[model samples]
Target chain A: MIGAIATAIIQATLVSAVYALIAIGFTMIFGVAGVLNLAHGALLMAGAYVYGIVVMRNIVPSMTYHPAVGVIAGIVVVAILSLLLYELLVRWVEDNVVITFLSTVILAVASTEFLVWIFGGQNIRISLIEGQFALANARVAYYEAIGFAVSWIAIALLWFYVTQTDDGRSILATSMSERGAQLTGVNIRMVRAKTWIIAGALAGLGGMFLGFDSGLSPLMWLNPLAVAFIAVVVGGIGSIKGSVAGAYLIGFIEQITVELIGNGFRGMPTLILLVGFLLFMPQGLFGREFAHE
Target chain B: MPVLQLEDVDVSYGKTQALRNVSLEVEEGEIVGVIGPNGAGKTTMLDSIAGYKEYSGSITYDGTEVSETSSGKLVNDGLVYCTEDRDLFPYFTVHENLQMGAQFRSDDGAVQESFDFVYDLFPRLDERRDQEAQTMSGGEQQMLALGRALMSDPDVLMLDEPTLGLAPVIIDDISEALERLQDEGLTILLVEQNSTFALRHAERLYLLEQGSIELSGTADELRDDDYIRDAYVGVT
Candidate 1:
């Protein structure tokens, strides 16, 4: 029983790390742009496909397939795609939430279809790390360990960027009040575009990590997307810290439920928790009441 | 030559015209006041000048045509507008709020200079610099708003109702600060609903009514005008 509990705890931490990585980008896009980017899942799929083509194709040869290069390529491709998304689609329809939602939905569908066309309808795998270790009577894959470290590092870097950098402060200012930002001579368009790019890159890195750990399929993004959306909403619609905490909360709930009941009921706890939070404590943990502003 | 000029400007919001063929100028280092009743196109005129509203007219600032310039560009060009609402970043500390005013400026030395200038102008803000803006009183918020505008080191400062919702003592303090800023060679175009305050401070005043300039004169000239006295100055 102790071993089983330890295993559940380890699994929860690993899973929560990945969820946090996936949900941070979604929360940021919503917080800064005030647009629910439904295409976020699609962007993750695009990143996975990009990684698949770059590393899994064997075009670079197994001897020369550097994981760093693959990750950078994935991030760069997604960042460029996100910038294009903002300029071409989001910028025009940003003020109207419904239109933004519809446009991003279309983009998501288009992206998924594009990926299917390019990569075919088969699952692809890229092994990031080659070993596993035992800890407290539970086994942990090297890939999962690396993913957890990367997620925390990324979160730390993002927090520093947002709190310490001038451009990041400008983004916070714009999120607070567009008119106020304008009066201060902040180029709001540039801020918005940069925010989307950062979000896309983060999503891409997350996809790469997830694909390396569990393999990738065209439809893999959907579940993670749902998980991220629930995390964002449960944490608080626009709070980064809330999103992270919410991700861990969901992750632990899922792992504990799976350990106690079974895989069939794994999703039930998160669903219930989401509903409870939405109904009772809408602000989520660490979320401010004026987050919408 | 005037530092700013508005020639025959007209602004409309949908079908309702907010400003009609309004023309005005602000000479360098002068305090020009615009006073009018509510809905008299006073705020609309400032909005048009600040590029927040669309208008059909020529607006020239510092010899450049600024009718098409965005508000962000206008601020970088040294024209700053402090709106009546005091649209501050409420979550930020007073110091951070002031820092935002100079976000686009590259010269750290100049930015620091402006910060010192503002702190000197309103020492109360310096005292509460670490406090969040939303926690302050209405008068302090107004002071922070003014200090924030000054932090941009604007060559031409446009103020809209800086004394609104403040106590009479606070109003006097703000009026004295404006006088000091004007003395320091800042070109100011002030819009106020308080006709008495405007007449006492402005070198020249424009009386706007129903989207048109009904009267324009020196402060002494308009203060004694019987119609102006009865209509705006609250003297029966």
Candidate 2:
């Protein structure tokens, strides 16, 4: 029983990090573009499926050379996909928030259904770094630990990019007051397009890691997207720090719940927490600045 | 040579005509004042020239046709319109806001020089470089807005309403700054409700009434007119 509890805690921590990456990118697009992209989940699925195909089929040729190539290919595939989507679909209806959101929902549902049709609704496993690590009295998978570490590094890098660079500063300005930014020569449209691409790429990375951790499935992205939305809402709409903090909190809660109760009731506690958060602290654990709007 | 010219420009918003056949010009090193009562198309005229509002006629700047040019390209070509509302990104520090002005400008030394120039123009902004812009007072935000335009190194600076919501002392300070820029041989297009302020600072003036130019003359000529005095000064 003690061993099972320990394993649940570790699994929860690993899963939380993956969710953090998705929430971070989603919150970023909301911050920069001021729209709720329901297609975000589909983008995540697409990334995972794309990466899965590349790694499984050795499409990149050099991916067989190293594990790092798999990561790079994953980023490139999602970026290209994101760019095309933005140019073709998202751009035309950008200013109309309602239309864009509906389009995103349509896109998410269609893409998910299409993938299930193609991949046959069965799980396809990926073995990027398949090994176990023993720490103290507990044995855990190396990929889980690696996923957590990669998430932290990615979040850190993203935070740095948003705060330290000129482009990042402009993006922040765009998030706050797009018209103001444009008056000062910010390429508002291009900035948003670039943001979508980056968000998609980050989602790709999260999906890639998730695929390696727990096999690729057409529907694997939905659960993570739900958790990501929870974290983003609990953290605050557009706040970076809030997203990270909320993710860790949610991750630990799930882990503890599974240990104390069971897997069947693991989701109930999160739902209750989310409801409580929305009722009392609707601004989020931080503030509206962190919330995705 | 006339550096900026708007010839028989007609502008509309949906169905309502905002500016009707409004024509104006500002020569190099000229401070051109535009005065009018409310809804006299003062802002509409400037917006038309700035490419924010579409106009039917031609807007030529520095001998180049600019009726169809985008605002970004026009800004890069050294025509900047400082918006009236004094909008600033609330989340950014004063320095960051200033840096955004130089987004298209790549020169480090020149950017630094412009930064220093703005600081010199408004020492209060330099004092609060790291502070968020939203925390500043209305006058300071106006100064920052003007400072932002200066960073673009624009050839013709069009100020919509620089003195709005500022204290009388700050308004004086802003007027002094505009005069200094004028002394530096910069062209300006001034739009203001306060005729006293405009007449004092500008070399030439246009009086706009209900979307049309009612009067055009040298500043001294407009300053002495009885009708102008009765309309603007509230003197019978």
Candidate 3:
């Protein structure tokens, strides 16, 4: 029983970091642009497939040199895709909340069909750093270790950007008060573009790690999307710190339940948490009203 | 030549007209005021100049067309608008708010000097640099807003309702700061609902009523006019 608890702790911590990455991007988009981005999960799936294709099939012979190439390619491809989505569609529909929401939902559903067309309906595997090592009582995979480390590095780098650099701080300022941002010479359109790129990069990294665990499929985005939704809502509507906190709490609860009960009950507890939060604490842990007309 | 000029300006919101055949100009290193009651299109005129409202007119600011530029780019060109809403990032510290005002400026030395100037101008803000903006009093917040705009080193400052909800003592502090700024040869286009406040500092005044310029003259001429004294002076 002690071993199970200890293993659950390790697993929970590892998974929570990845969830934090996903939820951070998710919440930042809503906070700044006021768009919920239902297409976020589809973008994550795109990242995984991009990594899988570059490393596994090697359709482009020149690009199959190293694992890092695949990683960069995955992240860059998704970032560009997100920018294209923004420039082409989102900028026009973003003013109307209902239209933006419906547009993203349609895009997400269309992406699933597009993925099935390209990769077929088969669940394809994407390998990263393989081999399991023992850490105290828990046996952890190299991929999980690398995922946890990289996730922290990304978070640290993001923290530095927002707090230390002017361009990045503009993003934070706009999230707080857009009119203030404009008064300070911060370009709203340019700020939105930067945010989409950053969010896409984060989703790419998280998706790459996620692909190693469950393999790649067109429909794989649904579960992570649902988890991100729960995490953001249970945490707070517009707070990045709340998203991180909620992700950790949900990850721990899910892992502990899986360890104590069974694998089938993995998602049951987080759903319960979401319902309880909505019913009792709708404002969430740190929810604050956004100033948008 | 005027530093800021608007020729035959017309502004509307959907079907309702806000300003009709409005014409005004502010010359270099002079103070001008637009005085009116609520919904007299005073704020709308400033908003149109700052790239917030749609206007059909020729607006030339420092030799560039206002309509052709984005609002943020206009700020870079030194057209700073200190709005009635204050529009501050409440979570940021007072010092951080000031930093944001000059975030896009390329001249480090000028920005540093402006920081010194703003701090000197508003010692209350200097005393509470680390405090969050949302926690400050209304007068202090107004000072911070004006100080933040000062950090931009603006060529022309357009102020909207700066003394709207402040104590008499706080108004004196703001008045002193404005006098100091005027002494430095800063060109300003002031908009006020408080007629006395406008009359106090503005050399030239334009009285706007029902979306048009109802009267225009020097401050003394307007003060002597019976209509001006009866309508605005008594109420505000």
Best by TM-score: 3
Error of 1 at A230 (Å): 1.7
Clashing pairs in 2: A236-A290, A236-A291, A237-A290, A237-A291, A237-A292, A238-A290, A238-A291, A239-A290
lDDT of each: 0.86, 0.82, 0.89
Q: Candidate 2, which segments miss by more than 4 Å at Cα?
A: A1-13, A57-65, A136-140, A288-293
Worst lDDT 10-window in candidate 3 chain B: B227-236
Worst 10 residues of 3 chain A by lDDT: A57-66
Cα distance off (Å), candidate 2, residue A101: 2.2
**How many pairs of residues collide in each model?**
0, 8, 0
lDDT of 1 by residue, A1-293 (tens): 99999999998999899889889889888887898999888887777767767776552344345677778888999989988989998989989999999999887877777767866667777777688999999999988998899889989998888776667788877877778888888997898898899889988988887787667777778878888989998888777888899899899999989988998998877888888878998777766554445
Candidate 2 per-residue C-alpha lDDT over A192-215 given as tens digits, one digit per residue, 9 for 90 to 100? 887887788888888888888777
Pick by TM-score: 2 or 3, better one: 3
Q: Residue B28 of candidate 1: its Cα lDDT?
A: 90
lDDT of 2 at A92: 89
TM-score of each: 0.94, 0.93, 0.96
Q: How many angstroms is the interface RMSD of candidate 3?
A: 0.6
Candidate ranking (lDDT, best to worst): 3, 1, 2
TM-score of chain A of 2: 0.90
Order the candidates by TM-score, highest first.
3, 1, 2
Evaluated on CA atoms against the true complex, candidate 2 attains a DockQ of 0.56
